[model samples]
Target: MEATIHKFEDVLIEKNEVQKMYVNGEWIPSSSNVTRDILNPANNQAIATVTEGGAEEVDLAVEAAKNAFYKNGWKQTYARTRAEFLLKVADKLEERKEEFAMLETLNNGKIYEDSLVDVEDAINQFQYYAGLATKPHGQTYEVPDEIQAMVVREPIGVAALVAPWNFPLVMATQKMSAALAAGCTVVVKPDKQTPLTLIRLFEIIDEVGFPKGVVNLVLGSGAVVGDALINHESVDKISFTGSTEVGKRVMKSAADSIKKIGLELGGKSPNIVFADADFEAAVDYALLAIFAGAGQICSAGSRLILDRRIYDEFVDELVSRAKEINIGPGWLEETEMGPLISKDHMNNVLDYIRIGKEEGAEVLCGGHQILDGDLKEGNYLEPTIFSNTTPEMRIVQEEIFGPVLVIQVFDTEEEAIDLANGTDFGLAAAVFTNDGAKAQRVIRKLQAGITWINTFHPTFNEAPWSGYKQSGIGGDLGTYGFEEYLYKKQINTALEVKPSGFYKG
Candidate 1:
């Protein structure tokens, strides 16, 4: 069978009663009745309108999730049932994947191919958690005494799931599927800038016969709806993916109630290229690491650590290829890189490019925005590379979430390690080298939770995904991620019950 391509207009959602907040298994409008236009960053045009929700709607969603967890038996729901529901959602999503991909491309401004990958990742999250739902949970322990003891994992009740805009569907599902699979009811909120894909996901959840209040979505700014969701007394756990600044705020808000939190936050990851590495593959992955998604990714390899032996040649080659990256609308089949998430983001990146130059970093290539004929209206910028950067420079230190990369050169392995771990962020790091033992040694020394050897951004669902230092708190994928929505309780039973001698003293 041949692959099918779609026109953005052809796969658009049918306009009905306008997209609304989903709560308690019902499609409803926000009490505020405020609406915002969802824009295509590539063209700066409104793709859809989503109702804005505030604290009032968050309370409602939390109430419904609480009721589902406590009153509707969702807390102790059978794992097999949860697995079945998850499988159903996966099947339904696979059926509508093309439409989902189109909507994602239109809404998120990633290349159409990247959008399809995101949709597939979302589906895989559901399926992975589906099997995990039915798998054995907890562990048995052997005690020195006569009592038999074991730990059982239970649902953590109501979970507040916050997603970012960059990879809308994938991030939302990364939080939602794990919570639902763990038998916890949820209230989901996508970043206000991009909520279309998540709204459609709610529609799918409703169709898959999930129990009322088992899942809900509240759409609004993080300042309003997000604050309410995190600070709500009934919310048991919070799973958030976004910037570190916002993540810090979330940690504080969650502290008000001491809620469990799993944050996949900001990163300025280092991609180190040693001279002995396969030079061509190194360049390939280096481009993929930072340029993919137009550098909106939190874990993008924004810091390129190059060995002095290959520094000049590698920088020249990288700049040449980055200059050729086809930038255009996401819906285009040939666009290698798309526009930033919005105009503000574009300006933000351009400002960083300016900062890099001021900080005495040489602009190897791409130091401005793309304002050419057809691309004038869009939030597009050139893929930028900055060399001759120091560890103390702001451009090397800050998390510029854009196509702006900083290059750092090191002479020895120790210097490379220091340069890689110098920043405050430790979300991810990669080493491209042919030496097997050196790869292992360097990777072990790197201060990052997610690391790659001779690779860039490939991650597996079976392994835990997390960060060290300021990047984030806790994990987001794999068994560790699933357990984030669960509560561990130890059950102890005496083999023979008898009253022990009581001491009055």
Candidate 2:
């Protein structure tokens, strides 16, 4: 499809040059002098040039964060002070919401409406952490033998937060906000494919008057800067959101340092629909789960498990609805879904569709690229659905992370739960049913971390989010997420005199 070319001035600051890295509160070109082209996936065009970082830059960023954490009084700052900084960042983000939204769409290839929501959520995350910073709680305990005991939660020192390209601004905020709230300086390594929004975020951080080196942004491929950040000795913790394979590598790299690690990884989430569900509502959620962000989310409900009785009807309706979705550049108001992140990602999705066909899954609709005018130049793939998919098929078990949904029929509730739980991932799952008892049963039996009943992708800042099993370790959002950046220390004091060694009782 020929992709629509929206004018850059409408979405981004026309004069803003793409930056390579934000180290010590300043933007500088990489020491290596190598640069990477930042492409607008919406139109397969070069939007800007970003410096490519290597090990030397990573070391500088880490050292800067460590110095800020220890010598710059960032960790010793009062909670309210940190909260104020976060609120200021939020204010700055709100002021630049429009510019950020446009940059998000231009870089990530998500619809303008969805990117706006992401920008809003990013701001909300900052505000949420701002409140959390001032409200950190400590525990006091009474002890015998005239001793007083207490437990305090302190910042874990410098943190390395590696964010994914799917939701660049929101994901970065998810880690950085929580860590900063906990009084930890941070080094953020945004995905190379969509580094523009995060580069812009660094500008906001500078404007907010955060202490120098409190927050750093480094741009490079995962193999370079990402690994360096994960393996840095001075980094006390690592928080990451990405694929499971890469998450494993990060975990391994962090093992040597024994750093605290929080991972929010991949998912092959299942959306179960029972015969008694509100069919229209269920279909709406199912489509939203797969098509939102072009199914690039880690929590995308790729597996749609339906009761055999309604299987045929659900498949027909889903395919029909998906066919009606408008595909174009993200800046357009009418576009529902945009292109994938890159040509490689687009090809990957198409390859998975081919594999589904070879594996004997029936293509209900849309197994090709959208090649119409304006979309032709972009990496646009049609929303696809596959029926008669078995649990063992790659299309059913693997996380395609694309606008593709696989349909599986189940004979009973037990079978539905079984099919849903039969994957290596346990990120998120959803069920559509009117029966409260059955919903409760499925919720209990399902192995996923976050379960959605009659809803999908409606996460709030107040809830703790993470995966079970191979989906990942540690949590994000809520109090649980804040605690990930902290370490606990217990204090015991003798309140009364103790007997000397020579004294007899």
Candidate 3:
């Protein structure tokens, strides 16, 4: 399909008003009668309005999903049938690829080509889960005393998924597809800053003939809609993707109801480079790990830990390469990096950069926001690089979800591992080294959930993706992810033979 670039006014579904919430497979206004404008990150213009849902909307969505789980046939449907519907959704997404891609780019301020890849990846996630719907593994066991036993996996009902704004459509699809594939009903509260693409996605879901109440969407701030969803009694599970602080709050809320929770939260991941490693390949991987998606991804390698032997040369090369990164509007074809989600977020990133400088780090390259002639209205920041950073600096400890990289040097592999594990987060880490034994040892010792050897950010649908500590709980994007929304049941039956326990009889 050809790419389509849409203006803010031309392709939006609703203008100057909150697009109605999708409940029970239909679009309707919130019971609260309140709405908020959804702004385009590129120009900070109001592109559309989204429902300002509150506790009341949360109740309605939960009730609808509960009804769908019990009263409706969505869960009871055959696994193959569910797979067929998911496959159909994937097909429809492919059919409307250009539209969804344009909406994602406009809503999230990612480059057009990158947004297209995200749409394609989202579709692939649906397709992958569709294939797995009928393939859940069950175990049959033989009992000792004339009893037969078997274990089956059952869907955990009414999942409440709260997605982050960084990769709106992709993250929503990741949780939604996996839950739906497992025959669970879902109520999603997309991040308010980037709700349009997800709302548009529900439009397609409605058109694809999903049963009423199987999937629903509500929009509002995290404090409003997000909190309500987490605390709802009927919600059986909570899957969230955002910051560690918010993840802790959600975990506490879920604790009240004892609801199952899956969290993919913040990261201060490290990308370690050894002197004997493939220099060109390591540089390329490091660049993509931080610059791609403006470094908003939780798995982004924000810390560059280099062997002290080659620290000076690596910093020079990295800085020189980052200087050439093209920053412009997402819609432009030549743009490599685009604006942050909003001016507020841009300012937050800038504040961190200032903190890095104030804390005694050297600015190796770009540090200021870019407000050039044509790009004045957008929230663009130059690809930033800092050197002479210590593991104790705030920049190395906090998740600066922007295109910023902090460089630090370590003398030995043991010291590098210690430095990498110093942070509270343990989401992802990478080691670039030619020494096979050292790489294996480092991988085993790293506290992160996902580690790369001589590479970075090579995620697959089959691998479990989550974090170890404050980064979050549970896994997403694999068979393990599917199991997160499912519960296990054991069944036992007496055989024809009578037990001889009571031999006196």
Candidate 4:
């Protein structure tokens, strides 16, 4: 398929030579002169440069966030009034959806169609949190002996949100909308590799007249800016979405001050295909399970567990369909998958494929790079499939974070459930079965934070999402996500001014 040429300059404003970070409502240069080039992984080209912030910038950003929370009307505003601002932000996002979506594709190498969904989800998140904003408060409880008591939910103050490169805008708003709804000030550090989309999004945020310092943006490498944000004393809470290894570091750093933390981390999710499942439907979903986002999704169903009865036929059909997917640049209308996020990531995925072959797993199809014609300069990996895999292989044990699917056969329902629960990461899993009773059984038995029955990768804003065990801590989305930014307090009031009977006696 011939890829379409996306002239980003036509849609987006001319690329500013250096995109300045937003701090205290001002677009300013970094404290240091350092900067990083944001690349378009589609062709390994530098698309834009952003000011790379560090400890000094984080200090300023956190201080600004703290001031906005304590010394301004943002926290004191009525819930409905806050909801109005959120609604406006959502409207603005809708108006500029295409521009942001295309920018995301150019910046992150995700298919333009999928990137549009990210923008739409971001807009919906703002709207959902806008509704929730009006409904998050304290409750009054009846008490005895002229004592009245109530529980109040208050903002946790300055929040530092660190978003990942994979789903930049959606994850940012997932945390940002919730924190803002709870009336907390925010300092956001978008991943340095793909900061353009969020930078554009923040322009709308600033235009909406969100109080100065209410929403701040910093652009920098994770080591310098991210560490400073997590360690800052003024930051009351931290919400991060990234790898599990980094999540541990964030948790340890936040533990020292007992700062509130919410983490949405990695996964090696399983997709079980039961013998009784609709054969064609399972095949289609299984393809989307791993190939969607080119398997860069945190919850990508990388482990395919097949019932022994359907194992041979299913693997054959899956390999046949995998070979037919169109691979090219994300902007192409016909392209089904895009390149890996970056050259380094592409190498990492390729290394896993090599390791799978060395470990004696059979490659059913696609185990090499596609460097032909227009794909030569890009980081395009053939959607690879490895069959005859075990639960103990490194390819099965660790997250490849690519479009490499490992196949495992199961003889019984118990074995399928056990294999799904075998991994250390329990972020997400799906069970494909025609029987409602068996679906319920598998859903209950699976150890993942999110589960799908006869479906794959479908999520809504109304539900909470998190993981079990090493998948990290806390959750995002839904009322649970909104509450993560809030701290509760109990008020005990005396209805009558009377001394204690014991003291009087």
Candidate 5:
């Protein structure tokens, strides 16, 4: 069978409803009756409208989640049953893969192909956590004494998850699936900018028959709904993915109630190209690292650290390839890169490009907006590259969250390591080299949670995903991620019921 291509008009036509929040297995509008228009970003069109949920609605969602955990037996559900639910959800998601992918592309403004990959990753995430749900959750230890003690993992009760807009469906699944697999109930607040896909996901969840309130969706601005969700006394844990500033705020809010928190925050990841590296492969990976998602990726390697020996040639080739990239609407089959998430985002990126130029860095190539026919209204910016950037430049230090790359040259491996580790973030980094021993040595000292040698941004579900510094507090996406929604308890049984000899005289 041939692959099916989705048109933006068709996606919009299919998405006819004025979307609403999903709470306690019901489709409802916000208590305030306020709504926000959901933009396509590709063409600056309002494709849908969603409830602008606030504290009132979040309280309701949290109350429902608490009830599900304490009153509805969700927290006590068997691991196999939870796993079965997860698998069923995964199947349902796969059945609607195209629809979700189209929604993701329309809402997030990423290339359709990237949106499809996001759906695939989300499916894999659910399936992976499904398997983990039924696996061994505790350890048995041999003791010297007669008493037997077991360390068992139990659900951490209600989890409040906040997802970012970059990979809407995938990030939601990353947090929700793990929390569910661990037998915890959840209330998810997808980024208000791109809540369409997640809202649809909850429709599937409701159809698949999760106990009422086991999973809920509250759509709204973060400042409004997010405050109530994280600071709720009944919320046992908080899992968030977004900027460092917002992550810090979530941490503070969660601290008020002393809830367990896991954050996957912003990054200014480094992509280093060594002198002896495979030049063409390094360029390709560099492109993948920075421009794959139009640089909206939290782990985008926006900082390119190049060996001075091959710096000029590598940068020239990289700039050439970047210029050749076809930038347009996501639905275009031939487009390689898509627009920014919104006009504000595009302007922000253009401001960074200006700042990079003002700081004495050369605009290597493609730093202007594409304001031509049919692209005038959309949020499109060229994949930008800057050279001669210094460590102190704001564009080099800050997370632009755009399709912008800053280049800096290094003379030695020690210098490269220092440059890579210089940033406050340690979320991700990549080292390109052919020498195996050098690759290992450099990666070991790279001071990042996730590192790639001869690669860029490929991650697996079987491994943990996290950051070393302020990039995040904890991780998500593996055994470590699965355990974040669980807490350990020790059960002790006495071998003898009789009391010990002589207490008082």
Candidate 6:
């Protein structure tokens, strides 16, 4: 089928035409020669025929990255030159933001504006990491016992960046720019469901003049490509963003070779609402937090904890507004919430909603599929909310990764804190209140890496993105993220003039 959206014609939007994976700076077919058609989630139509790869293709990419890091000049290349390449990539992306944003919408099933925002965020990450590329990464110290002492940060070699389908470019650039900025050669793999945007981004990376073998892209299932990259002995690091279930597999496989791993995994975060909060603002942000990407975010505020005083009124208001959300094709200007990534996922989310009902949870607003007109073909579900839910319910305990929010009522700040920190995942939490002291005290007690006092989700590029518990290890974004790509070494020199050497004995 031709691309449902004509705007993508100028971009790489041909139907059923083979798009090759990037390896050693060349676009090539997978070793297996297997291919899959990538469909637009908005209408479930084929947009591009992308090659599916396996361990052989992954080995080739890893070898290329290993060669680039050790044999090529990438290891010895000056930091400023690396910074220049990152800045150039950011600039090129800036120039084609509209084109890239449209592609994101067509491929990922998010609103056009959200797609643009994600693209802009990706550009900002590249630019931010570019600045860090030239900045000082190590420090010299004065030690009383030593003539000279210092610690230097060095890039980890041969990184494998495994990204997810949600926010494909944003998540890809989060790892790619940082790895490149730290002077680590990378083999990147986008999730099989959504490879078009990253494929196009690779085109931009090639145009920006990265050295051949410095950066490579292998597109395939996480079971194959992800496993190969994780277990590859030559790869010094593995950076992945996906579900916690797969993350466990990643941690196990990386242990086989002791490769350093950075993971930004799953979350079933809580969004708390106090009665004293600016009611309208709280309502707006709650909707934005859960339904923004159709709630396919790792850090999405899936659990909504409400103060008992406003439980009835707040649920009523939330449901009233949620019913008005403009659900349609992502390419349309009026679209607010788009379809889920695929039919299987849409059904998975629906299954959770069904489970919620079976567990005796109250369905407040939406609870079914959107089967109207053209939307019937797409993977669209409603912005559902469930109340009367206990902490033991599956809807409250698991990462549904959809626009389904479970409502919990709390009478006191302590109970709110309990509900917020009740889950196994600690990726993110938010509290909305007019009481500053309460906000501070409650937010501090909430167990999460990223927290907001009065907001739901606003992840800045300058700050660290991390998780506390099963949300996975290490982090992404900011200095903490940059540090993940590097290793610190201690150096000390004994003064001969001072006769500090003891080897003569």
Best by the lDDT measure: 4
Candidate 3 wrongly placed segments (more than 4 Å): 1-10, 14-17, 497-505
In the range 257-325, model 5's lDDT, one tens digit per residue, is 789999999899998899999988999989989998899999999999999999779988898899899
Better of 3 and 4 by TM-score: 4
Residue-level lDDT of model 2, residues 412-493, one tens digit each, is 9889999999999999999999999999989889888898999999998789899999999998999999999999999988
Per-prediction TM-score: 0.98, 0.96, 0.96, 0.97, 0.97, 0.97
After aligning candidate 4 to the native by TM-score, how far in Å is the CA of 432 from where it should be? Answer: 0.6
Task: Give the lDDT of residue 16 in candidate 3.
Answer: 55
Report, for every candidate in turn, its global Cα lDDT versus the true structure.
Answer: 0.90, 0.89, 0.88, 0.91, 0.89, 0.90
Model 6's lDDT to the true fold? 0.90
Off by over 4 Å in 1: 1-5, 14-17, 502-505
All models, RMSD in angstroms: 1.6, 2.4, 2.1, 1.6, 1.7, 2.1
Off by over 4 Å in 5: 1-7, 13-16, 500-505
CA error at residue 247 for candidate 2, angstroms: 0.5
lDDT of 6 at 470: 97
Q: What's model 2's lDDT at 433?
A: 97
TM-score of 6: 0.97
lDDT of 1 by residue, 183-235 (tens): 99999999999999889888889888888999999999999999988888999
lDDT of 4: 0.91
| Error in Å for residue 326 of model 4 | 0.7
